[model samples]
Target: MKFNFLAKEKNTVVNYENAVAFPLTPDYELYAAVVTTSLNASFYEKDTTRLERIKDLIQKSNPVFVAKLAVYARNEMHMRSVPLVLIVELAKIYSGDSLISKMITQVIQRADEITELLAYYQMANERNGVKKLNRLSKQIQKGLANSFNKFDEYQFAKYNRDGAVKLKDALFLVHLKAKDEAQQVLFNKIVNDALQTPYTWETELSKVGQLKYYNEAEKQKAFTQKWEELIDSNKIGYMALLRNLRNIVEANVSRYHISKVCDYLSNEKAVANSKQLPFRFLAAYRELKELNSKYVPMILDALEEAVMASAQNIKGFDVSTSVVIACDVSGSMQKNISPKSKIMLYDIGLMLGMLLQSRCKDVVSGMFGDRWKIINMPKRAILSNVNEYYKREGEVGYSTNGYLVLEDLIKRNEIVDKVMLFTDVQMWNSNMTKDSFAYSWNRYKAIAPNAKLYLFDLAGYGQTPINVEKNDVYLIAGWSDKVFDVLNALDDKNSALNYINRIEL
Candidate 1:
């Protein structure tokens, strides 16, 4: 939908001519749009104008979202180079927000370049109005100790000795000496230990055997014994298990070993302790399904239990409003949002649609592209329903005809309290009709006068098919499930604006 008040004004009168120009996007929407669109050049490289507009928006948007965008880029997208630009821009707008310090630590932990880490530390020091010697030393030590790359370890140590010392006061050297001594000891141990290689679930299990000296045959026996002890001991955390599922399968351990690991990882106690999201469990299920290993069934069953257990933490909407979730499964959605990431826009749309459906008692879920049809989702687990929906409808069409969703619902005389369309907002009427989305929306409005349409934009196309001001339509964009958290505030008449203003700086 067009936001007319955001246009650059030539006079006091509203600039209707520049209505299609860049509008004042809400902080959440801007953050979501930029973070998702910035993942790859495929989205922005083709449309330089949209890219420039987003960049301009970032320069003027709130710094809180800027920090959030940077964290999302690093943690969620696994990005290295792209987030640096945002981090640099964020440093320019820094105003002593503690969030910036957290972002700095994340960057230091994940960044490959020592120079980038140093730059972030300098910014942190400036914001805190003091050289944070202890904090910086701890962050550096943590990064070095956790690093799997030899080069990164060396670089972090080198920076700690040469670069960090120069930036700090002479009094800081006392603490630095202690940190240095600890680092040297840790580094020597890491280098001398053969089992201190990349720490994975399997590797951690192997470490148990390395705890004591033993012959080859004796070590094998000890490993088996220790593996069972560790499994039964409940020492392995859920994140360790979730991230290293492949390692566990490829270890070729006995079925009993695998079953025990799965049982502990997916148990209610572990799920509650780990605080893993339902979508993360769903993602794990998808990965295991693709592997098609012998343990797939067992792992899926365990993960299903974990997902159900974790669902209690997700606060579903308490409103008694009928809802319909229309997901876009068009060709554009197949494009990867991030480089080397298997998660595409289509996968995210489906997952979010199913997530919303799972939260609602009366919700109609459907997929749309060139055509539209109601999906018959069974009352089962969330991931099961998603898999079943995909199996029933192999693939939706290519073109993004979002209008067809409203049209089909209107034709069937199915008036819902709300229609949530998860799409890129690049809707076209394949029927060669004018204003098809608007036409169908108006017709639906005739029947359901109070019904609202929420267009969840996965891609930042900067355009919409319907006029939001004239119709009860709202736009929310982002890649994370946090985007859904704004729905409660959206129930107000002001929509996202109210939520944006209420966001803590």
Candidate 2:
């Protein structure tokens, strides 16, 4: 199943032809790659062709891709780069239709960063011709009325004075440092209102009280008092509880509070209701455990339970096909997937392999680097299995021997319906030949002519091991579960290109 919209070229170069090969690349990976490259601009700043290729891909992407890109940029990449390039590319593709409007609305509703929200609004108002400034102002005003915070106040005043709007009622609820008489009046009113509000552990309102007092000693006293109250309450929101535990030392909270937080963090009902991805919980647990080994004893059981529950929620595919999941654990994969992330590409590959394994009934798993070996994946929690596989890093070696896996499978004469490789797609033979993957894949095709190769590119290096234009080969990039959506799209005769071309207005 070949997607008609993909590039027809057989080259490995990063050009416009190769750029559009995977338009459905996960939104998170696409933005992460672009932002990562942009931050390290010194390397690709002079490489206009590569940059333009990425921009071209963004411009030609479908609404679903564009919408997800907008959300990712505003949320995940908010504090990274300006996203001006992406915004420009989005303007070229988005026409402020109902779909794009809904996308913008979703972004605005979830965006918390002032700078990113402003940028989003500017894009909607200037490029897409959507009159959103007034709507956003009203939303901000209502938010301030319901739950006022220092951050919201700061943004409100900043944007208000910048001519975004000056809601007289909400403006008076915050304090501004501006010299304008009107601004001063609003700021003073906000300070007075904040001081009047009762300080408690109800929400973040106590933090607002501390901010309103504007005295270091008074703020510290209030914060400590609030922490004391919270400890006695013995109840905390799931996310806030995790955050508090993460910053236990700085929080200066009690061990009793820490214990209670851990209890909630591991609570089976809460964990099940959290709906967080198992991989994410595992990653957070690993970081927290490393930060303070003491946390391990308290939270490890809950983390494992959460992981198992999350695994139960995963819906496996009903495809009756034999599958091979090959993961790349080479030295190159040790580097973080993005500069802002601590997660390495190897972690992503492992997680993705586990996810695919969960969805497939007849699947064989293998890990390859300098050599290839068939892995007997244990039936256990996904995180535990991934950790066990990770512990064998030394045995797999550091070189990328991707072809060996296919070659070994061919030798075994295994009848495979599909072969999926989770990698950066930068495959090179031990002998330094570029055609190792291609050569081995060709040989496998001769034996299993109906088999298809799905390259799950974890890193968007913009190079593929095989010519993606080939009917038997497919390329998908990203670290999102939605990558599985490609499977449904593939079942159709037109592949993912049909959905991409649906032209939803």
| Per-model TM against the reference | 0.69, 0.65
Off by over 4 Å in 2: 1-53, 60-88, 92-100, 111-115, 120-244, 248-279, 291-295, 318-321, 338-340, 358-361, 432-435, 492-505
Worst 10 residues of 1 by lDDT: 10-19
1-505 in candidate 1: lDDT tens per residue? 2456444232222112122222335464455556456535544245455445555666777777676666655554444654555655555455444555455555544324434554544554454545443454443433333332333343333333233433123223223232466555654543343212443345556576557655666656666565555566665668767866665665455789888977776677777667453446666777788785778788888876666555544464555878988988777777775576566677777777876776777788888877786786754477787666556443667777787888777778987888999877667666676646767889899999999989887786555666554578887766655556666557637655455445332
Candidate 1, position 332, lDDT: 71
Best by lDDT: 1
Which consecutive 10 residues in model 2 have the weakest lDDT in total? 15-24
lDDT of 1: 0.61
